[model samples]
Target: MTGGEVAGLIAAIAFLILAVGIAIFVLRVAAVTKEVKQTVSEVNKTLDVVNSEMGGLTHEVEGLLVKANTLLNDVNGKVATIDPVFTAVGELGESVSALNNSTRNLVTRVSGGVVNTTKATVVARAGQKAYAMFKKNKTEQPTK
Candidate 1:
């Protein structure tokens, strides 16, 4: 063959090889793109399921909060009803303490020598007179 013909043949062979290489690269890229598309579809499905579950969980949490509020209100109402009883008990305790203090003070005053000798003598004479009168009346009564 002539030199020009030989050069043309070599150029044609190189072009053919380059075209084949590009075809193989395109095929690999298409396969990778298909796999990526499938992965994205699966991810979307998973996200949808998670969203549905979250909605149900939120609803249950709302119900639980409502129940907790009701229970708290009930407890508060009961405490309110019992508050007067506790207050009355506290007042009763104070009253008892005051009575005890008065008794103690009276006893202390009586035993602490605050009563003078003259007053004591007068009290003793009055007690004797009252006893004598009681005995006289008892003896005067007729027995049936």
Candidate 2:
């Protein structure tokens, strides 16, 4: 071949080599960009999951607080109900003590009356016996 034709062929081959190197560099850059995008997507998904779990935990804590308040109210109401019963019991105790005192006074008065009646009966019987004995002795002694 002529010299000019040979030089043209060499120039074409060098141009092809430079194009291939630039294409390889572009492909490497595209691959690194795709990997970075995927990592960012995964981080967003993890944050979303954590946020949803926190919402559920907040609801559970609110429910527990409501239950505790209801239980406290029930205890307070029961105490209020029992307070009247305690007061009534104290009043009943006082009434029973008063009744006992009245019964004791009645029994004491009855006992005193019985003792006085017995003393009067004994004195009257002794006086009648002495009078009968004196009359019998006088009649038996001859006319005096």
Question: Per-residue error at 9 for model 1, in Å?
Answer: 13
RMSD (Å) per prediction? 23.3, 32.5
On lDDT, the leading prediction is 1
Candidate 2: misplaced stretches above 4 Å?
Answer: 57-144
Error of 2 at 95 (Å): 44
Each prediction's total of clashing residue pairs, residues at least 3 apart in sequence or on different chains, is 0, 0
Q: TM-score for each prediction?
A: 0.52, 0.36
Write the residue-wise lDDT of candidate 1 on 1-144 in tens digits: 999999999999999999999999999999999999999999999999999999999999999999998997787678558655555554555555555556666867879744233443444455445545544654675553
Among these predictions, the greatest TM-score belongs to 1
Give the lowest summed-lDDT range of ten residues in model 1. Answer: 115-124
lDDT of each: 0.72, 0.68
